[model samples]
Target chain A: MRLINHIPGRPAALLLAALPFIMIFVAYSIASDIRLTANPQDKLLPAPTTIVETAERLFTVPDKRSKEILLWNDTFASLARLLGGVTISAMLSLALGLAIGLLPYARSLFSGFIAVLSMVPPLALLPILFIVFGLGEVSKVVLIVIGITPFMTRDLAQRVMEIPKEQIVKAQTLGASSWVIALRVALPQILPRLISNVRLSLGSAWLFLIAAEAVASNVGLGYRIFLVRRYLAMDVILTYVIWITVLAFVIDWLLKSLSRRAFPWMEANL
Target chain B: MSFVSVTNVWQRYGNRSILERVNVAVDEAEFISIVGASGCGKSTFLRMLLAEERPHKGDISIEGGETAVEPNRERGVVFQKYSVFPHLTVRENLIAAESFDKPFGRLRGTARKQAEQRADTMLERIGLNHVAQQYPASLSGGMQQRLAIGQAMTAKPRILLLDEPFGALDPGTRLQMHDFLLELRDETNMTVFMVTHDLDEAFKLGDRVLVFDKPRWDPQDPGLFGATITYDFDARNKGMPFQDILDQYPSLSLG
Candidate 1:
């Protein structure tokens, strides 16, 4: 708490510092309000302590292969699809953005199409995608790719356009060919912003992943949530939700750390 | 043939005329300075010579027997703003000039060695040898401009075009740059065309000064933005040195 005071007025740091305590207080309040069943053998309400004990048992018990399989299967499946979709989106968007931004003809030709595509939300196209790619991994991954690429492309293209005209002019004056100028001057200048946009898209990509997995998926965190929701298993749903949050947090943190390490100059500007 | 001939050049932007039927000729190993107010088409004229802008009427020709208009290693230009690439070190900036020799061709082995050696020498000449490995952003404005000059000189161009190269520097550093440029000119004997608003800069470095005034295109009185040969002085005048000519024009004072 004293360390929190040393952070000056950073609201984000303060909020993060308060999160665990707030969650604990909420859990305590919810636990106190639970009602027990009249029948001794049949439990109607599970205590917050019982939920915690169950989670601990799930982790510590080596013999509980079923629980482990249930957790690992969905988690790994979701992660694999998320990674594949994001990777495809990132590569395609970056390449297309650079091309469009650098070349006037490409910009003129593709800009309108891209604008139209960007306006259509990926979720809106999910039904159509499902019809086309079928109710499998391909369809789910494609949906996520479609969701993320447009924003990424727009951000990356805008950053490329914002590269100072003087840099290009100077490069040309120094006898650098168009390709050299694009590769050396333009690419490096936009890299920091591109990395930033990639980090931003990761959140949206995860959101799309969950939404995609919720429909026609048998093995995923989203599927588990759906299954638990049918039976009103709020504890399992909460656990999976927590797991998703942690994974997203870790991924986002890693991306930001990588960005900082790769481009130290970006830190001061940000 | 004059070393560089700009004959009856007219530059315009849309309907507004900037340089109206201007003409000037530069000889071998001469340093010419164009001095004028901000809107008097000094930059436009430089752009015309650099082939960045085409004259609406008239032609520019170089005396070197080359017939076709090519982006030559023969004409090096230094802009008012230090146009050195922020991402590149001074050495990289210098090495980049070699690409102009043959479009899209690589410089390797002994040829690359020679270019590097030349770049190193030029870096030393510009007194930026210590900062050869440093990016332009890390250098002072004066140092960056000097690095730009070094980058230009690395290609060993026949004529150098400077568009108010020291305009952004502070007065003290401006004087230092002026002295270095003069010393460089003395050693290299390369022709230089500079545009400056500062009268002292024109007087100190120019072998001949061209003063531009707003052209009056009244048909009855045809003075326009095109610069006429208002005053041309040979810096090597026996009794009257450049300092004396500068003294004559009190309006061109450094202060």
Candidate 2:
């Protein structure tokens, strides 16, 4: 049979999906074992079991200096910053995006400025942010906001512009003023798009959060990952990396479910 | 003075002209069916009437009011697609039509109750009471068209502008919508201006059919000239079969 004609059944599909994961696990174990045999003191690719054990210790045990569990503290701190930055970005982008997309004056003024702003590499402003906002939670959170807000604003503005002219005209004929159209017509329609935009921006939000944490902060997933590099603690790093991936996956899943529940009408389009 | 008047109107987009020297006048309850070849500015004229866009020159006024600057509650409109708001339910769409009249675009407490009741009546009239709670996406093409018309009707505007409103429906569904539209039109003195490609439909539902075509065609440069109303046929006395008119214009197909 030709390759194109072959369609996998449920069991075959499940097996195919698991194959790469299984191969990676087996390869890592063999490589780690060989490295250990060559030099038992090697810390770089410690066995998978060592990583699992470290994860358990990090998750459940309290730190020696501080009573707080390191993993949970890092996760909580990172989450709080991510939430703060992303929330502020969403609100600001929605307002700015709607104005840019809907109003001529706002579009003429901000559209060009926003275009220039989006082109500037956000990481270049990290030092400036630190100097202005200081190296506290504010700087880190601001980095995330600065990193993702422009893109979200642009995406949302495009989505708003994509709304059929017919609908806008219809709304106007229904006696809606500009504010009413923005609130009643344009707002609800672009909300699902904003949710979709947020989902896509989560990865970048995480990246900015980690970068800010790594550069200056004491407690965060990124800080822990960067901090342990001096000790060659592969096991701790791997544990933190896996946990971060899990958190990102959970966040993406929650946003998907939220979009599904709230804007069921957008299913076909989304 | 006519109830709705368009005098010496000219529309152009930059160097390219779309409409020019368009003049028409209608009574309050006239059903003006506008038929034209594709890109003949029928829709543009309709948009001008709805005050969605303005002509480059001249004037359009309704109820002897000042020249319209923007779309208001005075003129309602429906398009073939995106006529109804997708986010709102069938009943809520009708309620929205009326509630949008308020400065804040809201109906509160007792007003909300009354609006909902009126919406229910509109739903019943549109034969969409079964799906009143459903969003526009769940509705069929014909049902959605009916809901769109019903939504436009709820505002009770003296003028209704339709841009190929039933152009997307199937043949059977199109006929059903026709009946529904005519029945609704009989109940009110609403003046309607509908743009359609189908000559038969233009004559079927319209008191007068206005044909938009370019009087002067420039072969080298199409944009050198614009289209205007070339023929105005009064189809009020003729009923059912529009064979006499179709027989006169062979280039115009049945649909």
Please report the candidate that would top DockQ against the real structure. Answer: 2
- Stretches of candidate 1 above 4 Å error? A1-68, A264-267, B64-72, B99-118, B217-255
By summed lDDT, the worst window of 10 consecutive residues in model 2 chain A runs over: A261-270
What TM-score, computed on C-alpha atoms, does each candidate reach? 0.82, 0.94
What's the CA error at residue A2 for candidate 1, in Å? 23
Binned by DockQ into CAPRI classes (incorrect, acceptable, medium, high), candidate 2 is medium
Q: List the residue pairs that clash in candidate 1.
A: B214-B224, B215-B223, B215-B224, B215-B225, B216-B223, B216-B224
- Per-residue C-alpha lDDT of model 1 across residues A1-270, encoded as one tens digit per residue: 687567545888799899998998687546445443344232334555666775565445643545455677788999999999988988888888888888889899887888889999789999999999999999989988999898888878887787765455556566666676667767766777776787788888888888888878988889888877887665567667777889888987887788778764344564
True lDDT of residue B217, candidate 2: 94
Clashes of each: 6, 0
